[model samples]
Target: MRALLVEDNDRLAGLLVTGLRRAGWTADVVDSLDAAIAACRTHQFDAVLLDRGLPDGDGLDMLRALRDAAPPPAILVLTARGGLPERVEGLNRGADDYLVKPVALEELVARLNAAVRRMRGGRRGPILVGRLEYDPISRAVTIGGVPFDPPPRERLLLEHLLQAMPRPLGKEALEERLDSFERGIGSNAVEVYVHRLRRRMEDMRAGVSIETVRGVGYRLRAVD
Candidate 1:
């Protein structure tokens, strides 16, 4: 798994990075909130290990910005503030998990994996259902283990839908997730992608189905 570690203490940061690597994960370490935000935008990470104290401001500031991100990565606050109020505040601010300092590497790794497991609904691998699988890492889809590459937008649309499994997603929500902040979406854009994706799935005889709820939104489901 890929991670972004935002901690100002040089020695601590190095230790954490080394520990993460030893645990079989690659991490990019940044010392400030600004660098953390920039790295987040430039790179896609499965989780972010955040320290509450930074030179510029509270790391919670970065947490707020990240919550607004599309498919926001999992966030785990690793700080020295162990007060009950502090833990409550961090979780309320959208942290997937929170850990106090002087934590063991084994416990940290376990907690991080637990956070991701909760986000993924206990699934550690791809979003799999019968013959179809959507791999989050590569943004790749396979049916009966056969590779299927949809158009870029359609591919992203599928990933978003699968991530939100068992929840019917509205058009407005899909548009916000797929479109860049500066890009204005056309009225029929979402419908077109949905329609195309549905047809592609049909033609492939895939073991998945996209269901449209009248006056509501679309949902992806595993079929028999």
Candidate 2:
């Protein structure tokens, strides 16, 4: 999942970004409300890790704006202020979840996943694409009821594409998302993973396919 992190503390933000990336998520960090708002305007995030206090203004102000976004991201507030009243106010304002400062990466990720699951109507099951199924929680892949384990990079590539199923993702965007997970990617890296994934799909005789759009990018499409 791709997220936007609204934090002012450099150390904390760096740690959050690293941990999030390690946990199979891509996040962009912003230190102020203005930057956060600008990011919200530009891109759609799966979630937002917001800090209550910021250099410019209270992060809730940005939250107010984001609440108006179409299909707004799940907002997870990470704040030092965790009084009951503060939590209530945040919730009333539109936060999906709230976390106190100095939180463990594990808990943060878990809560983020919970919020996303709630946003998705509590779906934590396999993602279906024709005859293929990809489970986000287990990082497991299955084709025609047969188990298949894709390499780490390959798995991440497929997961990313599947997350945006039915909609083609730009080649450059897909490459950026994959690079956030593993580095040293060559120019044809996306092609290589796609090719391997295709082979696996055929091996299982699955009805799923990743279609390449000549000038745009690739999309996960199910065949009849």
Q: How does each model score on TM-score?
A: 0.56, 0.77
Count backbone overlaps in model 1: 0
| Clashing residue pairs for model 2 | none
Error of 2 at 45 (Å): 0.9
Task: Mark the regions of model 2 whose C-alpha exceeds 4 Å error after superposition.
Answer: 128-132, 137-156, 164-208, 221-224
Weakest lDDT window of 10 consecutive positions for candidate 1: 176-185
lDDT for model 2, on a 0 to 1 scale? 0.82
lDDT per residue (tens digit) for residues 132-222 in model 2: 8888765567888788777666777888888887788887877766653224468899999999999988878888888998898999888
- The TM-score between candidate 1 and the true structure equals 0.56
Candidate 1 residue pairs in clash (backbone atoms < 3 Å): none
Model 1 has an lDDT value of 0.80
